[model samples]
Target: MAADDIAGLIREAIPDAVVEITDLAGDGDHYAAKVISESFRGLSRVRQHQAVYAALGGRMGGVLHALQLTTAVPT
Candidate 1:
């Protein structure tokens, strides 16, 4: 999938989230993303990543290969 398409998926999953997605290279399999949302407030880093993965509905396993994720609660 395209970078923006992947970004959109994340946004859809967390409606209140602010998502920034970037393809690390030309390869769609690798990506870097920064997401900020109130939903992440009390969640640990691992949990935050898990939430995003859950939003992808298992796509992370196949369609999406690698993701470097950063999650934060809004100030």
Candidate 2:
């Protein structure tokens, strides 16, 4: 999927999130993303990552490959 499509999935899952997806591997399968959301304000790093992963559904194991994720609570 395209970077915008990955970003769109995040937005669809978390309406308040600001997502930026990058093609780190340039393979359309591996990606890096930075996500900012109020929902992550108090969540731990792993929890935050889980939230984003969940947004991707089952793609993480199939269509969507490696994802290096960074998450933050918007200031």
What TM-score would candidate 1 get against the native? 0.91
Query: Model 1: per-residue lDDT, tens digit, 37-62?
Result: 99998889999998888888888869
| Cα lDDT listed for each candidate | 0.88, 0.92
The sequence of per-residue lDDT tens digits that candidate 2 reaches over residues 1-75 is: 889989999999999999988898788988999999999988999999999999998789688888989999987
After superposition, which runs of candidate 1 have C-alpha atoms over 4 Å from their true positions?
none
Give per-candidate clash totals. Answer: 0, 0
Instruction: Indicate which candidate wins on lDDT.
Output: 2
lDDT, model 2, position 57: 87
**Model 2 lDDT on a 0 to 1 scale:** 0.92
Ten contiguous residues with the weakest lDDT in model 2: 57-66
Q: Per-candidate TM vs. native? A: 0.91, 0.93
Residue pairs that clash (backbone atoms under 3 angstroms), model 2: none
